[model samples]
Target: MNTTSQPSTADRAFNLSTWLVDRHVEEGRGDVVAIRCGGESHTYRDVLDHVERVATGLRAIGVRSEERVAMVMLDSVEFIATFLGALRIGAIPLLTNPLLPGRDLGVIIADSRARVLVISHERAASLDDIRAGASEIEHVITSDGWADFTASDEDGAAYDTWIDSPGFWLCTSGTTGMPKLAMHTHGDVKATFDTYATQVLGITANDRCFSVGPMFHAYGLGNSLTFPFAAGASTILEPTRPPTPQLVADIVTTEKPTLFFCIPTFLAALTNSDLPDDTFASVRYGVSAAESLPAETFTRFLERFGVTILDGIGSTEMLHIFVSNTPDAHRPGTTGRAVPGYEARVVDPDGNDVADDEPGQLVMRGESSASGYWCRSAQSRATFEGEWTRTGDLYTRSADGFLTYLGRSDDMLRVGGEWVSPAEVEGTLIEHASVLEAAVVGERDSSDIVRPIAFVIAAPGATVDDEELTAWCRDRLAGYKRPKRYEIVTELPKTATGKIQRYKLRR
Candidate 1:
């Protein structure tokens, strides 16, 4: 708990994965559980053992610190070991969602230019068709079902050759085009942990944490993996897809976690479940990120679970949460305030600061911001303007500094010279009794003009027509802000990390 005396590692540059190992040594938590995956548990000491073996194995396969290593596996102990092991020797570990289809995976593979691939046996077969044409990849390390491969003499030895540089590469969600790989230095990732975990989450050794988010994403990587590990806290890591309320309920019931991190959609689903009282009795703090959390879900989370849902805004570029609302300062719908060592501002189209209540593009410059995109000269130039990273999110800052997310900059709609935020319309629509979830997009009108159209997902067993929904929006929103049309569907499209894919709806 006494973080005051220890000198900051901020200036002492290091790779993210190796710094984690240093923390484990300093904290003397080698015997503590570091990862709990699919009912299997591994201690910090166990993680260290794997790191040595994998680092040696990778070296035996001719992988160097500057070399690229890609992993396509479910969230499990092996995944963590392989990732961190690559880091131990300064190898750049490129992580991607294993559930991605062949076409998407092929694009990422080409983009990453990875020479080595670490994947599970089950997912390995799916690459049979793709591997025929993949000449760049040399070694294919399988976790399961490959029993014939012989271990090298250096398999369990340490790889003493270490280079000091960034540790990983992650492809961004290319909603606009092919995804660009974001280069997160080991130092950047560690900075996120120090700022958010120590300064924002205020975690301690006794806190039991659990993350439903996928580890490949920034949120899960920092908070679920790095933060908890650095703080000496234990986390439950289950490998699953679209974790439903039923699955979450089971995890909460059995794990008895104190802190829970999830997205808004998953939280809404949990609140809608018929779970018994005290189902989340052990949970004292709940954190939501990856997507905007509706006020309705926040209220329901508190009312039913008796724990405040602290919503924060984070991105892959920022490494993790740079703005957060902790338990002490619970702003129901806002994205809270910026973290220490960081500054944020809302800017208009011309790059001038906007008024307190005016919505503008959210621009931030900080220590934890990414250096730049990998290999994309044009993107790096556009995204990195000096030290600032122009976050594409649109937001309005209140007088008290709480950030209200309007939507993504590309998500804003302009119709008849009036600008509108999809979040504002979606927020109003979800407040209606019949709507469960809502997404708003700009559609072409009969005049070939652009206008806001809302897609509504009705609550279970509730049947309300589009006419009624449009009227409801009209009563709650301004004439220009009201939805011109409505599309009723069972659910909205979402990314693997649970963020709404608004671009998909636009198509």
Candidate 2:
């Protein structure tokens, strides 16, 4: 990672949107590019304009500092503008996946108690049936105006003159229970860019950052949006799901992005797909997070694209990644050393620190740790032991402080009362020649005995029967830990942020 410090003047005040405004005026190089469908390009100035109008419209509609604003929209330019606009006026934006079932969305809306709801045009039309989904929401805004607003601005509500303090509220993708909104002050996001962009990414005015992840997640919000703006760089906004290899390759060819951020699955798909030779030629850095990077994915990415996929571990509560591996320091399977100013440790269930090379719950303490979660005092309190956040995910620390991700606390299975990490099983399974991707979940049998059921996604043009894959696991894993059954699948379900939703498989 680049650690060169550039001199910067301390702002007497800080706001997330103001960062973009400052860049648009003084440092924006104008050559930075982001590509969307049909290869549409957006300049820094254009993005600034959109954010300004959205902020103005929101202010006119009564949004203010610390107010909760719920957003249910796809990946689009409007999503970015509305999100930043909410932050501009100090309104906390709570983002949820638009694809969530109506019942789930209703539960989230009710739990968040958002004062305002912003929906994309397409989403608005589809959600008409659930009009009163958020009873607490007083104002409703849409990309294509549904009520009194229009896509085109008419009221000369001066947006540039409106000023306010900035704050944000976002939900954590909890493995269980309803998601909780994490409270963040205005300075939180700005501080994120300072640490990640200036210190880690080494972003520059000329760099074009391409984010293939959802902006609703912290990875997309900070790494893709806020960090790039901090460096006066540009971003391409695509209002869609994971860009197919053809579309991603096309975007790369058209935009010539300098920095790319995605997860291992997408990277694997890109490497396996029929992308053109020069598709990733201009990229200087590539980052992978949200899930552990498979060793094979790392090797394929480097061999095919000539760009090292720097993997990291981060949580929504921290705002962005706290630990990462750079190209030079990267050990393919490890999550790498902790970022500067952050400390991490592996602790047993009793909260005692464990020795190196031993697996335990990962705990972290850092400047970027969130203040608290909204309305969920009990859950929030459980997250900390003093100031250290108990990351429910399990991990192993090496002698050099490199962290290797295990599975979630809930996902870890027990065989004869002994803990069995699914990640260890899946990693070993994927190492088999016939396997491409694998997920393991506990299956209960007639005797109330829980054993692992492996779901394997085989490599294209490769054939592996379920019985054969089960035997392969038997050879690699311990007798008690080996999969009791195997199921072949085309693909596994994942969250918008690319995390495998193992709970979905449990059902």
Candidate 3:
């Protein structure tokens, strides 16, 4: 394939956007429906046209190849177009959760040194605050104002980027409000599509896919955008943040998707809903990730909806799921074997493989692994050791190679499928004038899912109002990271070194 001109099957250079969006149009799939969102349908040709215009628009705004374009927009047609358009010209799109507060978003933008940012309309008010700290951001555009960036001539020169050039960056697994940014190459995108998406999903052009996970997340990126476009299939995108069960039911009933992607919390919500069993009749396979799926939830969903949920584990470092349960090898309790192109191993602290049934760190290596965290040399070295990337989750693999999750190796809690750092939460709690000290720990809720609970000691002569404290944290932390219940205790158990005994708090 030639890199200097339009990408084709005969070209030597590989660009993920061309392969995902433009190639479909060039390969006689122009008329095929590519995406369905907000009561609007776009064909491969239509999406490609938007991609071209966005690419030209970026160039007109002086965005060069390899520069980072930050996106804090929800799932929509504008998002797909801008993301692919940035890729079409070799500009890397940095994905940040749209729901994150301005403080957290500022950390990501400052760390990434992104000069361009695209946000949804609802986030416009935070623009002044977001731009204050991140001086690197020179231009900010709203999601709906994408057409304003376009030029009269949509034709633009595609950058001659190497296959291994950085294509995108994903912000994830942060211990602080700020976290590590995982940078993936263009090859990583296609590698995931060719490996996990094809082998595990068995996706075809005839299928329509929908996901409850947000598109900014790695799980949703693969489910709603990457796999569908690469396989010439159609995708159903939900613009509403945390779409209600009724909304999902409506889409499934009307759009008739063959594949459904979801997380554990949303799956449980749907299972507990009063929606008819046949609501999911059109779905062939359901995919779950971002957190370990409970067996009871899996059983209830399948029995109620008649859709088999394939549970898997993936990370921002690896791009997408590397270990998954397939229809042929079904396991409700355990995360199935390694994907065809990936390898998984449970290793001790010494980096040697551990025996089956012995809980150890889960490490994996695959074609989709990111280059490393941007500007985080220590963490990148700790995570990406030679070939394997440490997942930071403790698990036990059976002799037959089925992996079962135990818990996080660190004090981090997987609440609602998002990592919540106890240290971060505790720090936020103590910031309140009413709290002299605070210790946060994860406890199983009534649903048998993990959530954070905090033990706080009020300052001398200070009042601790649960409602007032809750509102304080609400203003400071992200929604998921906030403690669910605050325990106003007179004292907290501590070690001889004066360290807060988180284990005691857990009990």
lDDT of each: 0.79, 0.75, 0.82
Across 389-479, the per-residue lDDT of candidate 2 in tens digits comes to 8878899999998999889988899877877888888887877767778899999999999999888888767887877767777777788
lDDT of 3: 0.82
- Between candidates 1 and 2, name the one with more favorable TM-score: 1
Query: Candidate 1 at 4: error in angstroms?
Result: 28
Q: lDDT by residue for model 1 over 68-155, one digit each (tens)?
A: 8888887777778788878877788898878876557766776777888888666776586445444577788888732223244565
Candidate 3 displacement at residue 339 in angstroms: 0.9
What's the residue-level lDDT of 375 in candidate 1? Answer: 83
- Indicate whether candidate 1 or candidate 2 has the larger lDDT: 1
Q: How many pairs of residues collide in each model?
A: 1, 3, 3
On TM-score, the candidate that comes out on top is: 1
User: Residue 362 CA error for candidate 2 (Å)?
Assistant: 0.6
